[model samples]
Target: MVNWQFWKRRTPARILRLRPRGELSDAVRVEFPELAPDVRTYLGQAAYLQLGYFETLTRLIRATPDLAEKEALSLAAGAALRKHLALLAEIREEDADPAELMEPFREPLDAFRRATVGARPRETMLTVHITAGLLDDFYLALASGYGERGRRVARILRADNDRRQLAELLTETIRGDEEWRALLSLWARRLVGDTLLVARGALLLDGDGRGEAARAVEPVFTALMAAHARRMDALGLAS
Candidate 1:
């Protein structure tokens, strides 16, 4: 049986390897409708992603010295955990086992988590902010394709992530140091590749779906990129 509580471990488990998914370099046009994950894959991956974010933020909260910053990180971590539990409730309502649904997605998504883990506290903090922002936007967009259940999910995803304070903290750091500015600017940009990989991985898009994929992916990702720019601009970092 797969351990549903993989989140409790400090190190990621060595799960079964996943089939290769597209990298950012693939220019993977989403070609939605055809590309969206089925309901099970969607809910499973979405819930697990929130749990990953919560875990990462909670670690940051434990390591930081500043009380005020700890409070801010707690807010983001709390928000992520709430979303995870709520999504689990949603899965139960449909008579599906949440862990079973989430199992198939573990390896790839966990790999994505490891790639985004930053060496420094500040860099990790920014990682949570930037990656969370992008994936939430992408999931909310994908929710539209699911129906009434999807509508319910859109509402949950729309909830205040309580992350504004976190972003404010990062923005202050970026404005104060030119070196931090350059390093984090590049770090934030590099995060996009791994992020988009997980986002695309959550979808049902496969070789069979390739013929019309490009046309469908454009609108959702275009909006995602625009939101991403606003986030960077707000941080006074170039996107």
Candidate 2:
């Protein structure tokens, strides 16, 4: 059997070596043709996990009033994202059984994972606020560092009035634009590259100045949130 630990150690390097620049979809297809389709689908969703894309998707999701519709969007987006992560895990385990590697980092990763479980639902609320034209710095603070913590902060910020405002935004006018979509898509691709890099070891999450990898990602998420805000304002969705 291929040394599973070697595979785990090598996976990040392999992912990083596959792409130095250019389109991620192209890179992924070239690296693993069998997973190309799934890679494309995951990237689209991962793009949401990207800076502007996630917030935009969240806004779109919040804009819907039907509970079923909202739930479906969350499942669709979240599931795509989850599938991408699963692939990463599979790649990490390709050489050997993953069970062996799970013992070491499982706890911290799991803790962090649970911290972010609220993202899909809370994302609806956060996007709703941005759409309503209210920019809460505290909300930004929570979302700034590792996003899971940010979601926690956003929950605390969601007072009764905040919830009402978000509901109003959802019920208000909406105009879709191609430009915004294109910009968000571009941003998402870059974000995915950065995230993949971190996962595969192109960058360390705890190196010098990297305090926690999640903190490193804060700015990316923040910029994306700002971009979504700008897009909403540009489109006149927000006053």
Q: How many residue pairs clash in each candidate?
A: 4, 3
Error of model 2, residue 133, in angstroms? 22
Q: List model 2 lDDT by residue over 1-239, tens digit each.
A: 11112112222211111211111122221121110112222222222222232334455577778785566455434533443344344434345333443444344333322332224443334332332222222222222232343344334323222233333333332335555444433433333332323232212233342455445444434443454445445434442
Worst 10 residues of 1 by lDDT: 15-24
Residue 110's lDDT within candidate 1 is 76
Reference-based lDDT, residue 55, model 1 = 89
Q: Which stretches of candidate 2 lie over 4 Å from their true place?
A: 1-66, 81-93, 99-105, 114-120, 123-202, 205-207, 210-239
Q: Candidate 2: minimum summed lDDT over ten consecutive residues — where?
A: 14-23
Candidate 2 residue 193 Cα shift, in angstroms, is 18
Model 1 misplaced regions, further than 4 Å: 1-32, 206-211
Q: Which candidate's lDDT is highest?
A: 1
* Candidate 2 positional error at 225, Å: 8.5
